[model samples]
Target: MPVLDLLDLPAACPPGTPWLGLDLGENTIGVAASDTSRMIASPLELIRKTKFTQDAERLIKLMNGRNVSALVIGLPMNMDGTEGPRAQSCRAFARNLDRIQPVNVAFWDERLSTSAVERFLIEDLDLSRKRRAGVVDRTAAAWILQGALDRVRDQATWV
Candidate 1:
């Protein structure tokens, strides 16, 4: 399916299936997954980007193994809320992902997600710079997915 609104996910996917979240960077793809209850998102791992096909294959394997019913991809929009080349790249990756694996995909606005993760790591977690770099992307993926889950849960009461 084409990318859907984050709010549509609850209805579009199986109730108890976990969702996969991705924070796509030029050098790496950070991965996260929600629990079956969809209440929390946790970091999974990072995929070092080599080629599109290889990356898609790895993600597909992980999603299938984890019973991921949908994907919440981070869309890095400009500060002024306009989509730039990075957003376009994310969309392209989503399209390609679905073509290979045929799963539902959604985009969440990911402004400041990385910065937020970095801050938490530096201030709260108090990790060294090298250690922080190793985990920042996956942590950011969790941040993005958590934001989407919050919005989706809020919309559930709209009846």
Candidate 2:
């Protein structure tokens, strides 16, 4: 399937296929995946920043292993709902991925996702700063995926 908007994701993916979420940063790429039913998302792994080909290869390997059918990448929009450099970078990454992989790709507005997760880890989870840093990316990826899943569920109710 081709790339799609978050709101345009298919109502149902193939059986046993799951969606992957990505938090693409300059230094690392956080990964998350949904269950087959798409009810929950879990933090998977963090890929260190590398050349585009290397990053794409690593992502494809993970997708192959997890049977991922679609990708939901966090789009970092500005506070005023405008696209910025970060958002452009994400879109570029998606374009590159689409060229090399057959999986569907989509972007989800990810304003404050990382900050929110960091706050939760510090205040509620009481995790140390170092520990939080290690897992924040993956956690943010989960947060992004969960938001997308919730939207999907809500849309299902209307059908």
Candidate 3:
């Protein structure tokens, strides 16, 4: 399947199928999934980054088991809204994943998603630094997914 824009997802994906969101980091791939109703996004788990084939297999397995209809991956854009090496890598990952799994994939602008989640963890949740490190990625994944869900659901701010 092609890599789609956020707005294109609703038409491409089957209704009531859950969407998977990923924060693909160098060391780990944080996972999130929406409920079948697509109302809320919740952090699922993290997959340790191994070989590309292994990672793809694991992700495909997750999609299959979870009935994920589409994917919303966090695109690591620079603060100035420029595409850097990390953004290139994210596109490459999406292309390779499409070849392997053939799922509808969308990229959501994820500038500062990690930092924002970290800040929330520190200031509001008051989590320890170490604990923050462990959950930050997945939390960011939820943040990204929730943003997409909000847009799809036509929430106030997304408009």
Question: Which of 1 and 2 is ahead in TM-score?
Answer: 1
lDDT of 2 by residue, 30-104 (tens): 999999888899999999988999999999999999888899999999999999999999988988887888778
Higher-ranked by TM-score: 1 or 3: 1
TM-scores of the models, in the order given: 0.97, 0.95, 0.94
* Candidate 1: segments with Cα more than 4 A from true spot: none
lDDT of each: 0.93, 0.90, 0.91
Off by more than 4 A, model 2: none
Which one is best on lDDT?
Answer: 1
TM value for model 1: 0.97
Give a tens-digit lDDT track for model 1, residues 1-159.
Answer: 657888877889988999988999999999999999999999999999999999999999999899889999999999999999999999999888777888899999999999999999999999999999899999999999999998898888775
lDDT of 1: 0.93
Candidate 3 has which clashing residue pairs, if any? Answer: none
Task: List the pairs of residues colliding in candidate 2.
Answer: none
Model 3 CA lDDT for position 93: 92
